[model samples]
Target: MIGPQPVAVASAPLARRNPVAKLAAALLFSVVLIATLDPVAPAIAIAVELAVLPLFGVRYRVLARRAWPLLVSAVGIVVTLVLFAAERSGRVLVEAGPVAVTSGVLLTALGLVLRMIAVALPGVIVFATTDATDLADALIQNARAPARFAIGALAAFRLVPLLGQEWQAISMARRARGVDAGRNPVAKLRLFVSTAFALLVGAIRRGTRLAVAMDARGFDAGVPRTTARRQRFTAADALLVAGAVALGGAALTASILLGTFRPLIG
Candidate 1:
């Protein structure tokens, strides 16, 4: 019975909003931020996101854990930009042989990293706080999405977590069969690749079976389907989407006022 579980906070107002609202808000917020290239707007957006975490019932520590990958990417961006960026217009901050780090390059990297995090964080929060089933239901009910598409997406998303467990199980089964990489890095890499391949094959087989089962259940019948659970798009949900737009607009406005608003197209 290992499956996707809802992470929505029962007592949190935002978390209890319709899943489509959360998703639309996240999308709108991200789309607005994508129009800017400066760090200032993203910085402000990040601040706004953090400030509203409690309202969403998402703790800072939980968000950090969920967002560690973005932090790692930020580090990679800084290193890559420092070593290879051509726009070294500002004063040199560090010079080591062929490696030069300029203020301009660093600022560009920071902006990119910040923008990435700011744009991505809302989606992360939405997914983290919302249930897959609820999202699918909301999409079908509130957003007027096709049932086939929403339900299919929900099925696919539910299968994602099983991949990790299956990988572990495959690795253990292999090890039990006297397959070990030992100390050699090359052998370890080969083992990893082989394991991944095996997992992929298993996943494909499982997916094929699941698709057949769904088809047999008349999922593609094109007939109207009835829902056991109804998802309502309330006034609060509308307010959530509006808040996202306002917050994003405020961030961009702050950047423009500060004269650091770099348009993405220009």
Candidate 2:
């Protein structure tokens, strides 16, 4: 099942490559972007991140649909920070007891919100194009990471969508069975909590079944994997990682030159 609707970008050959490489690149680039709070670095990172939506066959509209909340929350964070951050020595914009806004504080708040957006935007980009199963295989096989953990993670990933559908189905079934799950405010809240608990129980049962199945197959932590599909880092993989590095480097350079690297405190 599709998580969200796939975007309309011309599907690139990038997804065929090893997912570990792309994941590594994403993690590395995000770490680099987050290591500093300089607005210049994150701003540049944001631009690069914008390019990802299209490149990953993700439509702009799809991104907007999903990312609008993050954008809103980022704005909310800035507003809250600006209001609540302790008054500082800089030229005051507004002054209230214990809560002060200054030009410097406003700049800092803007930088903070921008940085949060920049840091979070990339995972949405990469995961949009990336296949979860493929990524897990790459982690286990190509990276020689622990197979058990990778497999468990992959199981959880698959379960997310399945469980959601199951929850919806269960809710409909419950309603059809005269559960009195009317749309009244109190009833809706009760339905939500009850449905959530039911879903949890169902999930636990499914997890038990999955564990039994895995055990029957000798899917132990130390077991050597049997080859099914081969996973390797291709040339595209190198390009992805290299491109992330270049983008990160550019961000760092801009931050230093623009003197936007403001650390939180010594």
Candidate 3:
């Protein structure tokens, strides 16, 4: 049973909401924010998201851990824009040789980074708080998604944590066989690639076996499948989606009032 463990916060009000509702809320919030291309709106959206983390029983430390990748991406975006952006309309902040960092370029980069985090964080929160089984069940029951697709996706998701363990095991086995890369960077990269390839092959084999096992268990037998736990869409769930829409709209409205709202479509 070495699989992905669900976030242990059963008493969290928002975390206990229907999976379909959370999914819808995240999607709707992202969609509304996507209509604007300014830093202001996304900044507001991010503020709201952080403000509501406690309601979801997600601590600041947990969110920081989960969002480190986004922070890395933001740094990359800022650096790339500062170095290579062509639209340098505003005042120059820094100039060195062929590289010029202007306020316009910096603003655009900040907007992109903020928008990326704002748009992606909700999905991260949903997946972190919601169990795979509950998500699949909600998809099948509330969203009316195909059982085959939902169950298949759930099964695949449950195996994701194993990939990390499998990679480490493969690396250790290779090291035990005297396949250490030592101090050479090139050798390290080659070793990494070879280990990844081995992991991929093992994953494919495991997936095939899992598919066959599921088939044997009548998963795809075209008969009605009963759920062990039922997911219900409640009034609170509806309010959650509505609240997301309102929050996004308010952010955009603020941006518009501040004259920072840039439409995504020209």
Tens digits of lDDT, candidate 2, 202-247: 9999999988888787777465876467787778888889988888
Error (Å) of candidate 1 at residue 3 is: 3.2
Please give the CA lDDT of all the candidate structures: 0.90, 0.75, 0.91
Candidate 2 lowest-lDDT run of ten: 1-10
Mind giving the per-residue lDDT tens digits that candidate 3 earns over 73-144? Answer: 999999988888878989988889998888899889989999999999998888878989899999999999
| Backbone clashes in model 3 | 0
Error (Å) of candidate 2 at residue 185 is 10
Better model by lDDT, 2 or 3? Answer: 3
Cα-lDDT of candidate 2: 0.75
TM-score of each: 0.92, 0.78, 0.93
Segments of candidate 3 deviating more than 4 angstroms: none
By TM-score: ranked, best first: 3, 1, 2
Error of 1 at 217 (Å): 1.1
Clashes of 2: 1
Q: How many residue pairs clash per model?
A: 0, 1, 0
- lDDT per residue, candidate 1, 1-266, as tens digits? 24556454667978898999999999999899999889999999999999998888988888888889999999999899888887788999889999888888988998999999999999889998988888888899999999989988899898988999999999899899999999999999999999999999998999899889999999989799877799998999999999999999999999999999999996
